[model samples]
Target: MSGSDIAGLIAAGVFAVLVALLAVPIVKLGRVFDELRSSIRTLSDGATPLMDEVTSTVSTTHEQLKRVDGIAANVSDATANVSALSSLVAATIGSPLVKVASFTYGVRTAWSQREDSSRPSGRRSR
Candidate 1:
């Protein structure tokens, strides 16, 4: 063979060996990427059901809170009604009771005065 042809053949063989050696790491890197993709898909699949349950729980909690709010409003209304009723009862009974108390006090004072005027202003026995 010629000198240039021999040199060219050696270069081609060296290139082939280098390519073969580099291919192993490239193949392993591809498999690692595939495994990562599979793990991500599995994680997403598991998360779907958990997210759905969380949504349902949140909805149930919101509904219960609404019921509690309604109960609180009802209690507030009842309290207002009770307060109004108490004020009405006071208006209906308080004035007449005051007048009756004043009348009783006047009667007692007049009777006591009459007894005192009929007696001397001396020490009286209890």
Candidate 2:
């Protein structure tokens, strides 16, 4: 054959080898696409139930939070009432008890002084 014809034949052979190499990657890509499609279908099948469960749990949590808020308000009101009652009792009862204690101490001291003075100093009994 002539040099130009031989060069043309070589070029055709190179083109065919390149086409064969590209075909392998194309087949691998098709298999990857098929696997991706299957995985998407599986995810879609499970998503509905998972979404339902999440929504239910959220609603339950919201209701429990509301209950806790109500309980906290009640506890706050009760604490206020108890504090006011304690202050009132202290004011009403604490002052009288203090006065009585002071009066009793004064009386006991005066009686002791009188008994000591009635005894004669420097007089001995035989």
Candidate 3:
């Protein structure tokens, strides 16, 4: 009815209009937060399975590496055994074979020298 009362009413109406205008962006912000939450939930849901698969893959690789380590250890042991066996065979057979070969060479050399001495002037007819 008065000037001050009319001005207050106009101010309240303007405030209401401003609230209504700003509520559009607030509502849209709420919807964006909801979409972001849904996307995060979806990504977590997908990533759980991917992480499980990665865990299983790592477990499988660890198991395979353990098997490979065992195989490598066995190969190493076998190689050591082969090396020891070769050394044993060389010690057992190599010395006697060398002695026998040396004796054979000496006999052959003596025989050849005797035949040469029997020939005239150490020259063979051939």
Index of the highest-lDDT prediction = 3
* Candidate with best TM-score: 3
lDDT of 1: 0.97
TM-score of each: 0.66, 0.66, 0.81
For model 1, how many clashes?
A: 0
Question: What are the clashing pairs of model 3?
Answer: none
Better of 1 and 3 by lDDT: 3
> Residue by residue across 1-126, what tens digits does model 2's lDDT show?
999999999999999999999999999999999999999999988998999999999999999999999999999999999999999998998899899999999999999999999987896877
Lowest-sum lDDT 10-residue window in model 2: 117-126
Q: Model 3 over residues 1-126: C-alpha lDDT tens digits?
A: 999999999999999999999999999999999999999999999999999999999999999999999999999999999999999999999999999999999999999999998879955688
Give the C-alpha lDDT of model 3: 0.99
Query: Which lDDT values do the candidates have, in the order given?
Result: 0.97, 0.96, 0.99
Steric collisions counted per model: 0, 0, 0
The positional error of residue 116 in candidate 3, measured at the CA in angstroms, is: 2.6
